[model samples]
Target: MSDPRPVPQYGEYATPEEVAALRGTAAPGSPLLPQPSPSPAVVSLRGSTLRRLDRPVTIALIAFGVLNLVQFAGVLLDFEGFLEVATKGTSAEPIDFTDAARIGGVVLFVVSLALVLASAAIAVLMLRQGRIAFWVPLVGGALSVLAWGVVLVAIVLQTPGALPPAGA
Candidate 1:
C-alpha cells in the first residue's frame, strides 16, 4: 500500500516554485536539495562594554571605606572612654593605667585619623569617575577593611571577660 500524504520536500517553505522546480529536476529515488547557507554567528558587545571587576570592586571599596570612617569617628569621639574600658581590670589601680591609656589613645587616634583621610581621598577620586579611580578605591578599601579588623581585634582583646570559666 502506497502512502496517501505528499512527501514534504527539503527547503519546502523557501520559495514555492523553487521546491517544485527542484523536485522535477531531481532524479527519482535520489533525494537531493540545495541546502540554505548558514547565517553568520552574531557576536554581542554588551558583555564587553564594562570591565568585569570594576563595578563589584568599586562597590566593595565604598562600603569598606564607609565602615572605616565610622570606626574612626567612634574612636575619635570616645578615645578616653575606650582606653579606660580597655585598661580596666588589667591594672592594679586606675591611676597606674591612666598614663598608658592616654598614650595608647593618642596613637590609636592618630592612626584612625590617617585612615579616615585616606578613605576620604579615595572616595573623592571615585566620585571623579576616572578610570584609575576604580583601583584607588580597591586598594583603599582593602586597607580600610584591614584597619577595621585591627580595631575590632583590639576592642575584643581589651574588653573584660564576660563570663566565668566553665570549670568555675
Candidate 2:
C-alpha cells in the first residue's frame, strides 16, 4: 500500500504545490504564501546573567568595605599606637607622630571610608540597573589607598622632622 500523505519536495517549509510551481510545473491549486507569524520575543540574557554575577560581587564588596572601615577606624582610634607598632620592625628610625601626622591620619581614615562607602553605593546602583559593577569596588579600594598615600605624604611634607634623616 502507498502512503496517501503529500510529501514536501523542496523542503518541509515549501508545500508540494509551491515546489511544483517553482519547478515550472502547473500546481493543482494556488500555492498561497502562509501568513508570517509575529517573531518570538527576544529574551536578553545579559541582565539576568549580570544579576546572578552581581550578587556575589556585591556581597564581597560589602565585606571588603566593612573590613576596611574597621581597620581604618582602628588605626584612627589608636593613631599613635598604630604608628609605633607599624614602625617597630622597620629599619627606619622612629617616626615622630606630630599633631600634623595625627590630623593627616584622621583625614586619611575619613577619606578612605568615604570612598569605600561611595563605591559600594555606586556598585549597588549599577547592579540594580543590570550593569557590570565589580570594577567600582576595585577602583574604590585603589582610590582609598591613593588617599592614604596622599595624606601620609602630605603629613610628611608638612612635618619634615616626622621622618628620620636620609642617612639614619
Q: Tell me each candidate's TM-score.
A: 0.38, 0.62
- Candidate 1 regions exceeding 4 Å error are 1-50, 91-114, 117-135, 141-168
- In angstroms, what RMSD does candidate 1 have relative to the true structure? 15.2
Query: What does candidate 2's lDDT look like per residue over 1-105, in tens digits?
Result: 665868657655976676776788765554554434444442334435556777798769867877978867878766656776787877534556677767877
* Candidate 1 collision pairs: none
- Lowest summed lDDT window (length 10), candidate 2: 38-47
The reply for model 2, stretches above 4 Å from the true place, is: 1-51, 89-91, 162-168
